[model samples]
Target chain A: MHRIVAFFLKQYPFFLFLLLEIVAISLVINHNNYHKGVLRLGVSEVSGTTYEIWSHITGYFSLHQQNRALAEENARLRSQMPDAFKASDRKVFVRDDTVYQQQFEYVSARVVKSSVNRQRNILMIDKGVNQGIAQNMGVMGSDGIVGVVQSVSANYALVLPVINVGANIFARLKSNDQKGIVSWNGASYHYAQMKGIPGHILVEQGDTIITSGQSVFFPEGLCVGFVTDYVQSPGDNFYTIRLRLGVDFNSLNHVYVIRNLMADEQHNLLKENGDAE
Target chain B: MQNSPMLHIGRFAALGFTQILVLNNVQFGGYLNPYIYILFILLLPLRTPPLVMILSGFAMGMFIDLFTGMMGLHTAATLFVAFYRKRIMKVVIGVREEDYLGTPGIRDLGPWRFFYYAGAATLTHHLLVYMLEVFTFINFWSVMLRTLANSMVSVVFIMVAMVLFERRRHG
Candidate 1:
């Protein structure tokens, strides 16, 4: 008994270190965004408050640039307005009443904290559950798709951006309508990889990529990126394509959280179908 | 020589605050993040108990992780460094010189020795962090590059900080 006690006493630091490391690794592996969101609320509040103050000071310096970007986005949106398209048949009165139900709604929020360098990067936005934000909703910047909301607290939410290695978004090429999965390779923030794209599809440089709308998170036609390059392994059926992401993650400030109204219904139906199968 | 517990606590608060408020915001090319917060562990008095060192390491790491939402990457890495710090110190400044070693600073161990000690600890911590962070060898080269790049910046920052801020103790 004395020897055992002495042995443990001599190596208590090692034991304590091991215990703490185990706890950390378990927290990393087992605790998903739900737990992280709740666990991080206090920390986020403090960090977010500090960041808000810092951004206030720095916001003055970037007002012109931000205004220009917002203006460009506004112009792009204006060009897509229904009024911008001339009616081919002036005689035909199209009744556009109750036929279309709004599938997604956007809630505007400011990014309070973000990091691009980490392999599994996460971002914090100022809006949370109180502002109609929830887990698994999609987030989009003014320019393009940003990320998916992983978790939400009362007043803050965490976003798992596309730059994260664990992030995978369904995307399609606008040129040929071929679908692929977009994911980061943990290398460059500017570039992400598109996988599961069959080699036969003729993809070209600068071809636009958009959300496939196959998932419940993001709606179709949301801009993701443009193809920069592609290559196929000798015997593989899939071509690994590189993309230039449209959203500049490093400078992300304002974003919109997308609330999909029918997500739960669709998910339940799919789950039932899978069970039946 | 043992320093006052108050000094250690003060250093902890200072380094932790700087790490979260200042260093966390500083990133170069989305790769080089200099985590000078580990300087707290590296600068502890040599005679401090290993248990205290390890506990302090976990506390500091947890504080940074909480603020950054990195989950537990920093905590795990810092704990590893704290556990192996004595071994690393002995290796850097020969086993025979262990008795003469005080707190690891430029003043205590001289520039070269301090550099080796801090560099080894920083690299180990950074490598563990990036490895656990990426969690896969899918882009092994990229992870290696990130580790090397970040470690270089962190080591330089830690050395410069030691030189600039460490109080010169007279024998």
Candidate 2:
């Protein structure tokens, strides 16, 4: 025991270095439920303001590209606005956490570091610890859902995009009441697969799919994708739904990070009722 | 007595600052994030302790990790590079195993041979890093594609920095 103690004493600095690294790593990697004190919060807010300024500057030139895309979308929306009421009477979601909502309150973010070509494409957003953006906050561009915030500093956050293999979300066809799990095939950022739709359900090519709002990350009805193509298993009844994502991730310039005021309350309530399971 | 303390600090600071300022922002696609700053590990003097090299590389990685939000990837990659610095030196130029002799500068080994030396180390470091980042997802083709692309860009910049900095020391 004395020899062991002496050995550790001799290597105290090395051990301390490793200890500090482990602490830092754990704080970064698994800090989902951990919250630092208000002291750090104040620091974060200042950094957030600075990062926002940086985002505005870095993203200024790309404004024209975003403007053009929004313009084209505006024209399409003008042509199709009236048809919304005729098809099942469009409803405005009371909650903002789901795919069901058409409009949202959010701040536009620019990606500083991004990876889309990798099997796991994680994005770094300029929105940070001070911006009131926290872990697991959902993100989307003008075209569609982008990712969930994974890590945050005073001025930025790392987000895991939907194109990654680890992604799975509750989704449904916009035209029908059918629900399914949306998962990536790890082939392309443009496409993903939806499973659990009933075999008997009439699924057609080019039908739109959206969030079901069953989870906290999304509220109810944001656009997930459209049915680009689908295939049926030889012996199974359900079709493997193929979807083309609405967001053009490769050309991403601006995005919105979503925050929910009621996520914790709702989760706790559900847990108390045993419904969260 | 000849070397100014500020000048030494300035050299490393300049390399690291330029790496983050220039190379990191220069992505042709979202595919490449060039980590040319790690040449500091490759360029430390022969007399610098192996442990110090690892610690310095680790500290540098932590600074980047704070800004980038990747906690351990850089630290792990840099430490591995630092630990293997001597072995890589031996492989490139046959070393007599007498003393754990100080490293060979470009003056001793020449730039042509040092290219193979530094190139092999840089490739190993990049491949390890790319592998660690993508191992969880485990898609063979996709990981390889990203790794190869990132490695090529990283190697070009790393080699460029090494030639500019280390070669001049011996010259």
- Per residue, candidate 2 scores C-alpha lDDT tens digits across A1-277 of 9999999988765675566556544443442222222222333344345445555676677788878987986787687785554555347524354856433356677776555554456676777767787887888877778877766777767677888766788889988879999988666778889999988899988998888988777767888899988888999878899999988777776788877667787789999999973
Q: Write the per-residue lDDT of candidate 1 for residues A37-153, one digit (tens) a residue.
A: 566666677777777777787778778988898898889989999899988887895856589888999999998788887878889899988898999999999978999998877
Runs in model 2 with CA error above 4 Å?
A: A1-57, A70-136, A150-158, A175-177, A185-188, A197-207, A227-242, A259-269, B1-8, B18-21, B25-30, B96-108, B135-145, B161-171
Clashing pairs in 1: none
CA error at residue A135 for candidate 2, angstroms: 4.7
* Consecutive 10-residue window with the lowest summed lDDT within model 2 chain B: B96-105
Which tens-of-lDDT digit does each residue in B61-109 have in candidate 1?
8888887887788898998898788788888775345534567678867
Error of 1 at B23 (Å): 2.4
Model 2 chain A: lowest-lDDT 10 consecutive positions: A31-40
Off by over 4 Å in 1: A31-38, A41-43, A78-90, A275-277, B95-102, B169-171
Instruction: For residues B1-171, write the lDDT of model 2, one tens digit per residue.
Output: 213335445655776656544565566555677777666666566556556766767766665544343446566666666766777877776655432343344545567665666677767777766666554455666667766778778777766666666534432
- Model 2 lDDT, full chain set: 0.68
Evaluate fnat for each of the predicted models and list the values in order: 0.70, 0.16
